[model samples]
Target chain A: MSKNSMKESYKIKDNYNTSIKIKSLVITLICLILTIICLLPIYLLVINATRNTSDILNGATLIPGNETLNNYKNLMALDGFNALTGFKNSFIISGSAALLSVFISALTAYALVVYDFKLRGPAFTFILAVLMIPTQVSAIGFVQFMIKIGFFNTYVPLIVPAMAAPSTVFFIRQFMKSSFPLDIVEAARIDGSSEFRTFLTIGIPLLKPAMSVQLIFAFIANWNNFFTPSLIITRTEKYTLPMMINTLSSDRYTDYGMVYMGIALSIVPLIVVYFILSKYIIEGVALGGVKE
Target chain B: MASNAQRRIKHVSYAKYGYFFIIPFFLVYFIFSFYPLVNTMRYSVEKNLSKEATIYDGEFVGLDNYKHILTSPDKNAEDYYVHAGMREGFLRALSNTFKIWVMNFFPQMILSMILAVWFTDAKLKIPAKGFFKVVMYMPNIITAASVAVLALKMFSNDSFSIVNNTLLNWGLIDEPIQFLADMKLKRTIIAGIQIWMWFGNTMILLMSGIAGINPSLFEAANIDGANSRQVFFRVTVPLLRPILLFTLVTSLIGGMQMFDIPYLFNPGTNRSPGTQTIAAFIYQIYMESRIKNTGHSGAASVVLFIITAALGSIVFYINRDKDEIAAKKQLKKLRKQAAKKAHGGLGL
Candidate 1:
């Protein structure tokens, strides 16, 4: 009876080991497949960006070609190919929007977290409710409002709307709740620091991580914003990177090579920004997930 | 007594300071956002078109515009004029939006969850996982219009498109597919592009959720002779429900507001009637009113706002109820387990 039991146990153990190996192999294969699928479109973008219109239409090669520089030159020579102006517009809009949003959101979060107020619950709930409303729902009204207020075709509409982002406020609030210690606030208060001063000097400094995340989020949102600009900005010279890229298709020449080049050029800044701030972006997204 | 008055003054000053700190955001919000929202709601009730129009000058439309847009058969036709009730174009756009939402949002969520689970599995040590993540997420950082443009090129019906070429080379089809031109194919391709752009964000969230799960729980399940599938279903899924729900709700809201993809895909030249979303439809009405010299675009905006708000609230409420039920079940389970342990000689 003992020998029979030992043999059965050995058989069971063997089955478990085999299954584990199989599961690992299966998962590994799946990951490989997904990674390839995810990377292919980007690879195609790069390849197409390098080739001339004819080569792009004829061949699909994985390697870098000699026509890359020529294609880029042709792209830059196109009408409305003001790379400098596009970059300037994008940077100004995205940077200003990010700074303003982070500041406002952080201050609001600070007040909600450190202060005792009668309307705190209602105020926070209001912000949360705003997060649920789609921005497009108000797109029409916002455009009309912009035109009425004489802010049409200007950066004010873009930068100002971002300041009241409920998502940023919510994120900053969560960060303050979890990461900011009450003892520090109390100590600051005991040291005769006013609430505003404490928030500005102490709270804001401590919120660097959250602020960084908010900056990236706000920047990305503003930078990628095409719908609002499309609706409001009709002037060719006022076009941001996205709006400029959209205008590429409007050209009668229809240079596929130049179009791809423009697409590639438009994405390069974001890729650079991502590489620099990826750590914060990942953490912000993770934290944002935790709250919802 | 003097010090007591000073303390009261100080308290009042602090309250004022709080208000001062919040004032900047309020100012911007009120001017750029809140006022627009209020104006939208107000405009929904009134009919005002001219520069001389006033709240009192405008006749109260009541809910007539909403009724006409929602219930009128004439409004539901594709080629119907924007001013002649609800147009058929608007209905087609609404349906396209919902189709894109279902096709893109759910698959993106599910695939993200699957990828997250696979990445977090202990047995699979995928090399360069971080690199792949960065690559996948790069598209997310790019402007949506640019991505749409790239998608346009890649899915072009021309001989250059990889999709068409591959299919033809593989003998899968005798002719190239017009991915963006045909209605069904257009929606699918657009949804595919959107999913490609967004899945990275979902994957990142799901990965974090999966990472938060305690390893010992899986170990305990393994000790009980549970298979991988069972462990995922019984342990991982229940714990990850909140994150999944969050993804679903956010995606649904985002999906409903989708405009850039369809807009960029169709552009102004193609004017593919079938590719218009409700947002695009609203934009079209606005354009027509501006160009054709009419004021009915305001009416269309009112209708669009109502549809978006109604749909958004319904989804939000449903998800909230589901979340509350799940929370209650978790609480009940904890309580029963506690009671059982209390009645026994030792804790489980």
Candidate 2:
């Protein structure tokens, strides 16, 4: 109970805290190293993109060389590997697909949530069944269908069928059931607003948060998708960024530097999109965890 | 009463609008998705010549293609995997698929467990945790094609290849490893890239699961004089069982259908040394065989579909809650006992 005894107790507590700190420091170091290992391949990629092909073939090192300008020059020099054209093609396909997909999915979701029609149960079950059928299983028939309708190498086949995005519809329907109150729709109807107008004006704005998450996901799905595109898209000019990046690797006489440069270019937009929309994308995937 | 009747009628009429809203989706689904799905079945039962190939030119063989893919005639090839004096394409693809998945999945699950524990532990006080998470998850978001290409180049036998050069320089090997050409090494590199691309996903998923656990549980453990390791094993992992099962099952489904990464490893080609996935084989048959062998491709798809469905249901069954399973078993036992008693009473 004396002052000297209290000071000695305080010193003991301080010693314990420092030991904890040392333990934490070691844990932190280990995590940092693992994180570095995860990112090191990508870092090597970006650094090598800046180096010439000759330098890259000589050896792989952490130190970045200065051939970025020449790499870009050679990359752009290749026919059909034009970054500008690739970006434009990708934006058009993915942007349109995401927008159309989410809009239809939300519309379908709204109908299912708000109305108690006869086919509502069956329709919901149908969507659930569709969710289990992997897209790859349908690839052959889909490509054949596209070719039958003479829609190959066109964006129509890519963008239009997004209306059938069962997962998106399912997610949005769940969101609506949780958040959307029927009274609001009734109130809007009483206010003389048409159903379509009400959905466009009120329902969409209210559903913006959920829609943005699904939209970003749809964009990424369509943007990075290569297998289907590779099947249907025959022309070089019609190629999306992923398809273009693949070509960079598989070309007969390949330039590793140029390929890396192209890969770097393809990923930058996604990383930018992630920084902007990562909060929602992460939350969306987590939301799916609870659903499962 | 009359006004109420009128409102009721209008409301009933308004209900029809549901049909209006859903029609576009159903229409597109039926035309683009459902139609093709059924058509794949149709294509599965046909035969044609490489049929320089026009659509609708093949004759229906009625399960011949299925038979061919499910049974191989070559009993002695001197090389390649054979079972029952034969090698089925479907079986080889099934085995290859599982081999690649197991190679990546077990290691990924363990590593992610450790990382999830590290980053989520407040006591660890890991610096720059956000930055690390973002970097680690970078590969998952990037196109699989790019990852494949980068991996192929990195693991190649070239003197400048990082994997080869590093190992060679460290005197770990006498010569460069033929990562691309060697059968085992090819699968290893593919599996390694898959692990690289996905471990972060599994980690993030596990981290979310950890965060979802009640904080009071950890406090109770602490009060009981539990150490961090004890808390992790006893308090944390048990609570994370559902999430872990979720991750495991979803990854199983995803890994089974893996195509782009393997295909991109060696594009425009029918064969890769050791990296042929089921989905990749389907793509190869559909692309290379033209119109004549459409049934063969369709058969492969059917096989893949069956595998995915069967495995998915099995995983779900395996991961069913223990309490629910026990309760169901008890109910079944009670029903049997009741039935037996009724039968004995009837005999009396």
Candidate 3:
């Protein structure tokens, strides 16, 4: 109620505001430094992709160079590093695998959610059990089985297993548990729709958001998958993008510029996709992180 | 109308349809996953190996392969590398895997925790938070194989590599360091790369975990005159336990399966003993080594499977809905009580 008391209160408030301001400024600077640390490697790769081999060998530089066309030409001329073929093979495998995984996982999740069958609980338990088993455990046997069955060097081994992605089904089922309305399925059935037809017509559309998120994730995972494909496909011409990049480790490929160009090409598409759909991908990860 | 529809839906037996819908998944899984798992176990016990470039499927040898890879020889044995059993190599690989995982996981946890707390703090006036997150997560989405190759190029043991060149230019060292040849430096770089690629992902997951905590709790802390440090240790950490447990279990399982980075970091015959993970060990015996030994690979895989199963069950148990379990227990108790009362009345 007095002028002196008011002045004291104002001084205290000013001190608090300045302290908060200092804290924010310090945190922001830390974040900026972290951002640079994350991007610097990829940035160097891109910049070196444009430089000549001698320049890259001499040292790392921040500026772009004039040898972009030369690097591309050298990469094309290199052996066991066909970028086009690698791209084609990777695209076919990843695209088909993603489509199969999302569709089948959605169907499986739908069954687990929409039905009240006797084996429903048991079926889910089986999936959970399967989820616990890592693929590396069975990898040696898988390769041998495929070899005996004459499926080695074929895309079947890579693509078919996508249909049984327990983790994807589990994630989608989690998404549906909170959002899917059972009444819609009943309404569709009463309107003379067959059960499968109802699922195809109504259930799938309702699950688009979850399906899309899983689709992107599945595609990226399949694309980046190296171990299984490396085990299956041993032929040089049939190599995936990762296999191609891995071959660059041999002592023969001493051309640093060309190697940088190859690595850059492999990662550029994912970066482009990330820049565009990052909001969904980041949110999807957050959604998947929290257990029901 | 709703009642009629409900009645019709109840009368219809969609059970078989559910069976039909899920059959494809189970079928694929059994053929691709379950059968192979069984086959791997069989191989572990069988004499399926290549000797002198000839493949042989000899009689079943129970536990021989496991002992061969797991049992150690005499303590005073000479020429350790020439020993019949590979227990030393296998153990070394397992330890290396653990070392690399621990080296990366602790630093990653600390950095991610700080970033997550800062980003999620409502009081902090952080700018461009979204941009920062996108950039940070960019490394995780890139092909790890490519990232490894990029790392090799950067830290190669020659003067021409990026890292060596930069250090030489900055006058930090008189000569280029042999990064991949030396065990310790190689492990450190591999661990550093692991930290770089994963900290962003861990940060995001932790941020979501922190966000799920009730804001009212923080406000209550503030009203009680608790500082940020006290609030973090008391309010936030306690509430974030479940998610933290989930992260730990998943990270452990993932660490057990770490293959691409360590395997690709030092390719060919020069792979240091310091960085050979379990997965790499399996791959080498079965695929890369001169003598292909499926039995040893299969036996090692069985060990990995057991570890993963144990870890996975912990997650499963923790994730089981507590409320549902309690509700089920209550229902069973009530049913028992009613049954007892009915029997007593009948006797009277």
Candidate 4:
């Protein structure tokens, strides 16, 4: 009786048909295609950098070309543009904005979560209110203010304001609620550490994950920021990478080879950073998934 | 006992330290954020000759700039505020902005929702889920300027036009289509890019919403013999309402401020190429060093702010769920009844 039942069950298992397997195969193909679509443009960017301008007129294929050195030469010879200076300026601005904003925001988050302060509720509410106010509203006056205070055409306007990023502060506060505990601060206080010292030694280390996430976000936002800088930085020498790419595209005789090369160069840092922090970015999305 | 009480008071007074930590944020915000915001309002109503000119030097224009935005003095299609002849007018730019946003947003939400649901569906047995999520999000991280340049180069009716060529290769068209030239085509292409760049972001938000749902709920639905579509609509969609509202509202705000791609491709136009947005209009206004219409730009920015704020509030109001409100009321009533009963007897 047991053997017969075993045989019946085996027959039932075998009855699962080819149609289901084919369905799964189709689903796999669709998913793969979606991934490829996401990835293909970037591949095209890299591939196009190696092809000639005129040669590509016939229609550039996904296939690799032998014109990489020539395109690099073309990019180097492009007038009124310096990739090196743009990269340096971009790095300085984005790096400063990221570090300053994240640290200051974390500091602010630490304050709001750990202590009972006067105006705490109001200040937190103010941050929430300002988060709704998009940057464009004040951009006109910001540029005007920058000009009035002799701040235009300088990185001060770009880097300093990042110190008060309310969004970053809010995000860090959310992370702290779940991950950071108030008792840890009390423990440090009990052990006779200074308040600021406790934050540095105990609070910051715990908020590292949140810090990196905001730092990358702040960095990307600052790096890709073309609007404000376009209004402020009129000179070529002070151009950020995005601004440089815009200038390259807007030129009268836009060189396709040089443009592609410049674009490829601009995305390389972001792509590299993404590869390193891809896991964190995906995870961080969920972390920031819900608004508190 | 008095001394111990005083010591306790002092311990709690360490709350003063909170003020110290919080002050820097407020201070910086006051200078960089608050001050500019107030200054924007002030500048919007005045006629400043140039930014180099003092604020006091400018005449009070009252609502003239704002009025100028709405009631165009010249109904001419080709009228420009500055020598560059870029700005079409405030209203025209605004309409164009909305036009592009509407074209882009509907498609974006629909596609993002489908992609989000499909990728996260458990029964799908999707492969390389992590890889796809990361790659899809890659565009969001990269600069829009670079992406615009890539898009234009690939799609332009030139020898370097990969898209045009592919169509020709596949025998889809006899000639390379003028993607950047035709106004309608240009708007569609611009909208398409916006969709491409943002769907991943929306998908992740939806995925997080899906992840937030309890697994037992899905299991229970399965036990009831609910198919994927029914489960999605009945259980998942209802549970995901807040997330959906958040995405939709935020996307609208973002769409209104859509500048980078259109600005990159079609700079300093009023509403030319059908791709011009309000942001580009404002930027163009500021860029006009020749005319010095900062006040007009300020007015336009104010308008943009109002539109976004109004939509954002609507988001907040809708997201306040009705069932939750009723549940809270019921809980309060039950607690009140329990308290009365306890007072009447030893039912603690």
Q: Pick the candidate with the highest DockQ.
A: 3
lDDT of 4 by residue, A37-113 (tens): 77788888888788877766666677878888888888778777778889899999999988998899999999988
Please give, for residues A142-176, the per-residue lDDT of candidate 1 as tens digits.
77777777788898888878888777887788778
lDDT of 2 by residue, A20-139 (tens): 789889977877787788778878988989998788876778998898888888889988677778789989988999999899998999899887788887787677656656777777
TM-score of each: 0.86, 0.86, 0.95, 0.88
Give the better candidate number (2 or 3) by lDDT.
3
Candidates arranged by DockQ, highest first: 3, 4, 2, 1
TM-score of chain A of each: 0.92, 0.88, 0.96, 0.90
True contacts kept of 2: 0.48
Candidate 3 local lDDT, residue B125 = 95
Between candidates 3 and 4, which one is better according to DockQ? 3
Mark the regions of model 1 whose C-alpha exceeds 4 Å error after superposition.
Answer: A1-15, A289-292, B1-13, B46-60, B74-85, B169-172, B213-216, B288-348
Candidate 2 CAPRI classification by DockQ: acceptable
- C-alpha RMSD of candidate 1: 7.1
Tens-place lDDT per residue, model 3, A153-216, is 9999999987799888888888888899999987787788988899899999999999998898
> Which DockQ values do the candidates obtain, in the order shown?
0.43, 0.46, 0.64, 0.55
Kindly indicate the candidate among 2 and 4 with the higher DockQ: 4
- Predicted candidate 1 versus true structure: per-residue lDDT over B33-81, tens digit per residue: 7777776665556664554332234567786545445554454565255
TM-score of 1: 0.86
